[model samples]
Target: MSEPVSALQGAIFEGLVKVEEAGPCGMITLRGDLASTQVKTAATGVAGVDFPGQGEANCAGDKGLCWMSPDEILVLCPYDQAGAGVAAIDKLLAGTHYLATNVSDARARFVVSGLDAREVLAKLTPADMSPAGFAPGRFRRTRLAQVPAAFWMRDEHMFEVICFRSVAQYVFDILTAAATPGSEVGFF
Candidate 1:
C-alpha cells in the first residue's frame, strides 16, 4: 500500500499564529490496566519512555507517551516504527487483557506556534490555555471548533494538535482563520 500523505502537505500558513502540518507520525493506542506493574514496565520497554502521569506526556528521544485515561495511553513515535512498536508492546503484555492498535492513519497532527498560538486555541476549546493551567508537557482531550481534538505543548511557544483524519482539513482551516490578523479571541 502506498504511504498516506499528510492531510495538508506543504500547506503551511501564518497569521497571528503559525500553523503547519506535523507530518506523519506513528500513533499507537494502548488500552490496559495502568496500575499493573507488568503493564507499565511493558509499556515503557516498548515505548522507550515512561508512561506519563494523568493528563501529562513524557518524551524520550522521538517517542512520546501520553496518558489518555487511567486505562489508556497513546504512544507516539516515528511513523516507520509504528508496526514494530505495536508488536513489541503486544509481546510485552502477553497473557494480559490488553489492546494495542496503531492509529496513525486515523489521526492527523498539526503544530500551532508563534506568539498567538495559545490565543488561537482559546477561541476553539474550553481548555485552560494559560501557562499556569496548561503548562508544558501537559495534554488535554478537548474540542477545537467543536471538533474532537487533543493537544499538548512542546514548550511555551509551540503546541501539537491531533484530530481525526476525516476532519483534518476542517480543523486546519478553522485554526488558520482564527489565527488570522484581527481575529483575536481574548483569553478567559
Candidate 2:
C-alpha cells in the first residue's frame, strides 16, 4: 500500500496563521433526505456541540474547527481520532442514509490572521470583509486568484481558506504576495 502523505511542513512566517495541512482530520459528509437529523444528532452527541447551519462555521475545544456546509463538517483532530470519530458519528446515524469518508487528503486549508488579514483578503476577494458583510461563523464560496475557494470567516481578523490540493500553492503564493507591501500592483 502506498504510504499516506504527511501534512505539509515548512518555514512559518510571522503575522501569518498558517493552518498546516491538517493530518487525517476526520470528516463525515451526511447525504440523504433525512441528513439534517443525522447531522443534528451526531453534532449534539459530540459533546453537545451544535452543528452549523448552511454557510456557517463552528469551532470546538479551541482547535481548528469548521463547518463546510449544513450537511458537511470538517473536524481537525489528531490522527488517532480519525477512525473512531467517524465510527462514533456513524453509530449515532445508524438508520440514516449518510456517507462518511476521510477526505483530509483531498483538501488543503490555511488561515491568515493578523491586523492585515482582512486587507490582504480584500486584494483578491470580491466579497466585502466588513463585519456586516462577512460575519463570524459565516462562509462563502468565491474565487481566489481566479481559482474557486471556500472562505470561512473565523473572527474579525482571521479566515479559513480551502481549495483543491492542486491549486493550493498557487493561491497561497498569490495571497502571500498580496500581503506584501510592493506586490499590490496588478491585483484587482
Candidate 3:
C-alpha cells in the first residue's frame, strides 16, 4: 500500500499567529439527498458529530462533517482511516442513491491558530473574520488570496483551512505572509 504524506509534512511558521500544515487529513466527499435521514445518519455516524446546517461545520479537532451544499457533505477523519470511513458510508447508504468518495489525497489542511488568527486570516480573505460575523462552527468555501479554499473556526482562537493539494505551497506562502510578525493588521 502507498503510504500517505502531508502536503507540507507539517511545515510550521510562527508569526502573529501560528500557521502550519497540521497533517494529512482524511476527507470523504459524500453526495446525496441531504434531507434524507439515511444520508444524514451516514454522515453524522461516521464523523461522530451532529448534522450541520447550511454553511456550517460540525467538527471537533478536524474530525467531523462540513456541509458542502444542499446535497453534499465533507466527512473528516484521521488520514489513515479514510478508506475505511468510505466503506462504512457505502455500507450504511447502500441502495440509497448516495455517492461517497475518499478525497483525502486531493487536499491539504492547516491550522491557523492563536489569539491573532482572526486578524491574520481577515487580511487574506473577503470573509468577515470578525467575531460577530464568523463564529465557531461556521464553514465558508471562499478564496484565500487567489486560490479556492475553505475554512472554519474550531473556536474563538483557532481555525482550520483546507485547499487543493496542488496549491498547498501557494496557500502556505500567502498565509505566512498574511501572518508575518511586525505586519499585524489590528483589524480584528
Candidate 4:
C-alpha cells in the first residue's frame, strides 16, 4: 500500500489567526456501550485517556478520546498507529458487540492558532465559543458553515478542527475567511 497524505497538502492561510491544514492524524470511530466496563477499559487503554464524558475530550500525551455521543467515541493517536489501535481494541473486546473502524484517512484536520482563534471559529460554528461557556477539554461536533465538523481547543489560543476529507477545502475556505484580519469579532 502507498503512504497516506492529508487531503490538503500543506495548505496555510494566516490572517487574524493562523489557519493551516495539519498533517494526517490517526482517527478511529469507536462505537459500543460507553457505560460497559469492558468497553471503557479497552478504549481508554488504547487511547491513553480515561473515556471522556458527554461532549468532553480527554487526552494523555499524543493520544486521546472524545465523547461523540452516548454510544460513540472518537479515538485519536499518531497517524500511523490507527490500524493497530483498532486491532488492539478489537482484540480486547472480541466477544462484545462492538465496532472499531479506522477512520484516519477519511477525515481532515486543521489548526487555527492565535489569540483570535475562538472568534474565528465562532463565525463558522454556532456552538458557544465563549471562554466561560466552551472551555478547553470540551469537544463540539457541530456544523462549520454548511458542513458537519468537530473542533476542540489545544490551548487558550489554539483550536483544532476536523471535518470530512471531502469538505476540507470548503471548511478551510470558511475558516480563513472568518479569520480575516479586519473581521475579528472579539467574542472570546
Candidate 5:
C-alpha cells in the first residue's frame, strides 16, 4: 500500500522548493509602537550579543542567533535557549511599552539557496532581486507565492524565506513550480 502524504513533508514541485522544517529555527514576535530609541535600548539590553541596527543583519555567530527587525528577532539557539532568550528580553524591557510574544511555532521557515534562488523568488515576488535592488544582508516583508512572507537575503545565492505555518505548504508548492528546470519565468 502507498504511504499517505504527511502535511510536513517537503515536496519538490517545479523549481521552487522548501526545507523539511515547518517553522524557523526560532522566532520571537514583538509588537508595540515605541520610539526608535526605546526599541533600540530594549533590544540591546536584552541581547547577549550586539543588535543589528536598521538595514543590517546581525549574526550571533557561535551564539546561533539573528535579529530579524528592530522590534523582532529570531535566534537559532538550541530549543532549550528559547525560553531563556524570551525571558531575558522580557526582563530587560520590563518598563518599556512593548509586547513580546514567543512565536516560534506560528511561522515556517525555508532556506532557499542556489544559483536559481533569486530566479525562483522573482516568479512570485514583485520586488527586484537585482544586486542594485535587493542587496545581500537585506530583508523585506513581502508576499511570496501569494502568501505573506519575510525574505531575508543571506547572501548572493541564498535567502531565508519565512511564512505562516498554515499556508506554508501552498507557498512551497508555488516556489517549486517557479524553480522548475527550464522554466522561462524569471523570479529575480
Candidate 6:
C-alpha cells in the first residue's frame, strides 16, 4: 500500500513565480442570508472567524471564510474535517434558511507565490490585483484565463486560486506557462 499521489506529482516548473497544489482541503459552500444572526454565529463557530463581508476573507488559525457573494461564503478547513465542519454548522442552523454543501473534492486550490506571483495572476484575471487594491484579507470570484476561479490573498506575496477539480491541470499549465521564462507577463 502507498499514499495517494498528488494530482501534480513530479511536476515542477520554477521561474520568478512558484505554483503548487494546496493538496486536499475542506471547501464548504455556505449559503444563507448574510444578515442572519444564526448564519453568522454558526459560521463563526466552525471557522473561528466572523463571516466575511462581500469580497473579503477572514482567517483564524487554519480555518478561513471567504465571502463569495451577497448570500454565499466558502469555508476552508482541513480536508478530513470537512464533514465535521458541515455537521457543526448544520447543527447550529438546524431550522434556518441555510445550505452547507461540502465541495472539497469538486474543487482544487493552487498556491501561487514569489515576486512574479501577482504578475502571473494579472495575465489571467481582469480584477484589480494591485497591492493597494486587492490587498491581503481580500478575495474575488473571477475567471482565470477563461476558467472560473476564485483567488484569496493571504498576503502581498501569497495567493491561492481555486477552480473546479476537472480544470486544475489546465489551470496549472497556464500559470506555469505564465511564469516561464520570456512569457512577457510583467508584474505590477
Each model's TM-score, in the order given?
0.94, 0.75, 0.96, 0.97, 0.76, 0.92
Give lDDT tens digits, candidate 5, residues 41-153. Answer: 54444444565545555445323334455555554443345567678767767886777766656677677877777777877888777778777766677798577887766
Return whichever of 1 and 3 wins on lDDT. 3
- In terms of lDDT, model 6 sits at 0.84
Overall lDDT per candidate, in order of appearance: 0.86, 0.61, 0.91, 0.90, 0.61, 0.84
RMSD to truth, every model: 1.5, 3.9, 1.0, 1.0, 5.3, 2.1
* Model 4: how far residue 146 lies from native, Å: 0.3
Better of 1 and 4 by lDDT: 4
- Residues 28-89 of candidate 3 have per-residue lDDT tens digits of 99999999999999888889999999999999765899988888999999888888989998
Candidate 2 local Cα displacement, residue 181, angstroms: 2.6
For model 2, how does the per-residue alpha-carbon lDDT over 59-94 read when each residue is reduced to its tens digit?
A: 654333455554456554554555676787788877
- The candidate with the higher lDDT, 1 or 2, is 1
lDDT of 6 by residue, 32-151 (tens): 997888888877877888778788999765689999999998998877788898999989999878899999888878888887788888888898887776888888989999899999
Best by lDDT: 3
Better of 4 and 6 by TM-score: 4
Which segments of candidate 6 are over 4 A away from where they belong?
A: 1-11, 184-187
Counting only residues 3 or more apart in sequence or on different chains, how many pairs clash (N, Cα, C under 3 Å) in candidate 5? 11
Q: Write the per-residue lDDT of candidate 1 for residues 23-57, one digit (tens) a residue.
A: 88889999989888877786787678877899998
* lDDT score for residue 177 of model 3: 95
lDDT tens digits by residue: candidate 4, 1-188? 88789999879999999999998899999999999998899888788887788999986666899989999999999988998999999889998899999999999999999989988988888888889878789999999999999988878898888999999999999999898889976655
Look at candidate 2 and give me any clashing residue pairs. Answer: none
